[model samples]
Target: MPVAVGPYGQAQPGCFDRVKMGFMMGFAVGMAAGAMFGTFSCLRIGMRGRELMGGVGKTMMQSGGTFGTFMSIGMGIRC
Candidate 1:
C-alpha cells in the first residue's frame, strides 16, 4: 500500500493580520490626502476661508477663557 501525504502548511500571516495592515495603510493615506487638500484650499482660496476660520477660532478662544475664569472663581469660593 502507498503512503498518502498530508496538506502542507503555508508560512504566511492570517486573514486578521492582513485586515489590520490594510486598515493602517488606509488611515495613513487618508491623513496624507486630508493634509494635501487642506494646504491646497488654503493657498488657492486666498484669505477668505482663513478670515472666516480665524474669526470663529477667536470667538472659541475667548469663550474658553471666560469659562475657565468662571470655573476658577467658583472653585476659589469653596476653598
Candidate 2:
C-alpha cells in the first residue's frame, strides 16, 4: 500500500520518507563518485602496487586542508 496524496493534496513523500530518500540518494551518488574518481586516479597516476595505494591515500588526505580553510572562512563571516 502507498499514500496517494497528503492531507494538503500534495505529493506523498512524508517527512521521514523524504529524509530517508535524501540520505539514500546521497549515499548512492557518493559511492558512485568515489569509485569513478578512485579508478581515474589509479589510472592517471600510473604508479606501482604499493606506490599506487599510497598515492591514493595521500591524494585523498590533501582535501582536508581545502575543507578546513573554507569552513574557517564561513565561520569568520558569521562572527
Candidate 3:
C-alpha cells in the first residue's frame, strides 16, 4: 500500500497544528495593529508615562486574544 505524504515528503500537519499556526499569525498581526492604535488613542486622550504603557499593553493583549480565538476557530473549521 502507498502512503500519503505532504509536499516535502513529510506527514501533513494535523488540525491542531493548523489552528495553532493560525492563532500565532493572527496574534502577531493583531498585536501590531493594537499597539499602533492604542498609542495614538492614549496620546490623544492625554495619557502619559505608566498610564500610556499600561493602556497600550492592555489593548494589545485584548486584540491579540480576540484575533487568535477567531483565527483558531476558522482554521479548525477548515480542517
Candidate 4:
C-alpha cells in the first residue's frame, strides 16, 4: 500500500522502498544492456536460429537479476 502524505508534504520512502525502486530501475537498464551485448556476441559467434534467441534471453535474465540485487543493496545502504 501507498503511504499517506501529511500536511507538511509527502514523507520520504523507507529503506525497503528505496531498495525496491533501485532494483526496478537497475533491472531495466541491465536488461537492455544484456540484450544488446548478447545479440552482438551471439551474432559474432555465428549463432543462428533458436540458439541465438535462447542465449540472448538467458543473458538478459542473468544480468537483470545480478544488477537488481546489487542496486538494491546499494540503495539500502544509503538509508
Candidate 5:
C-alpha cells in the first residue's frame, strides 16, 4: 500500500502557530486601516475647521472696518 502525503509538503501548520500568525496579521491590517481612516477623518475635519475660521476671520475684518467707519463719522460729527 502507498502512503499518502498530506498537504503542505508533509509539514502542516501547528494550531498555535496558525492562531498566533492569524492574530498578528489581523492586528496589523486593523491598525493600518485604522490609521488610514484616522488620518482621513483628521484631514477632513481640519479642512472644514480652516474654512470656518477663514469665514469667521473675513466677517470680523468687515465688521471691524464698519466699526472704524462709524467711529470716524462720530468723530467728525463731534468736531
Candidate 6:
C-alpha cells in the first residue's frame, strides 16, 4: 500500500498554502496592473497594452503590506 507521505515526517503543504499563495499572487498582479494602467493613462498616453505591461513588471518589484493582510486572513480562516 502507498502512504500519503514518504520517509519524511512532514507532509506537503496543501489547501491552505495553495489558497494563501494564490491570493497573494493575484493581489500582487492586480496592484502591478493598476500601476500599469495609471502609467498608460498619464505618461504613455499613446502607448498600448504591451508597453503598459512592462510597467507592471517594474511595479510588482516592491512588496507592500497588502499581500500580508490577505495572507493573514487566509491563515485565520484555516485556523
Residue 73 miss distance in model 6 (angstroms) = 14
User: Which candidate, 4 or 5, has the higher lDDT?
Assistant: 4
lDDT ranking, best first: 3, 4, 6, 2, 5, 1
TM-score versus the correct structure, for each prediction: 0.39, 0.42, 0.91, 0.84, 0.42, 0.39
* lDDT assessment of candidate 2: 0.56
Q: Record all residue pairs in model 4 with backbone atoms less than 3 Å apart, i.e. clashing.
A: none
Model 5 stretches astray by more than 4 angstroms: 1-5, 47-79
Which one wins on TM-score? 3
Relative to the unseen true structure, what is the C-alpha lDDT of residue 31 in candidate 2, on a scale of 0 to 100?
49
lDDT of 5 by residue, 5-74 (tens): 5775585555455555554555455455554554465556664577655644554454444444554454
* Collision pairs in model 2: none
Name the lDDT of candidate 1: 0.51
Give lDDT tens digits, candidate 3, residues 1-79.
4545888889877878999999999999889989999999999999999999999999999989898889989999999
Q: Write candidate 1's Cα lDDT for 2-73 as tens digits.
A: 433456754555444555555455545544554455455555667466675664455445444444455445
Candidate that beats the other on TM-score, 1 or 3, i.e. the better one: 3
Give lDDT: candidate 4, residue 14: 80
Better of 1 and 5 by TM-score: 5
Q: Show how many residue pairs clash in every candidate, following the order shown.
A: 0, 0, 0, 0, 0, 0
Worst 10 residues of 5 by lDDT: 70-79
Compared with the true structure, model 4 gives a TM-score of: 0.84
Score residue 10 of candidate 6 by CA lDDT: 71
Which residue runs does candidate 1 get wrong by more than 4 Å?
1-10, 43-79
Those runs of model 6 whose alpha carbons end farther than 4 Å from true positions after fitting are 1-3, 6-10, 42-79
Candidate 4 off by > 4 Å? 1-8
- What is the lDDT for 63 in model 1? 46
Which of the two, 2 or 3, has more lDDT?
3
Clashing pairs in 6: none
| lDDT (Cα, 0-100) at 50 in candidate 5 | 71
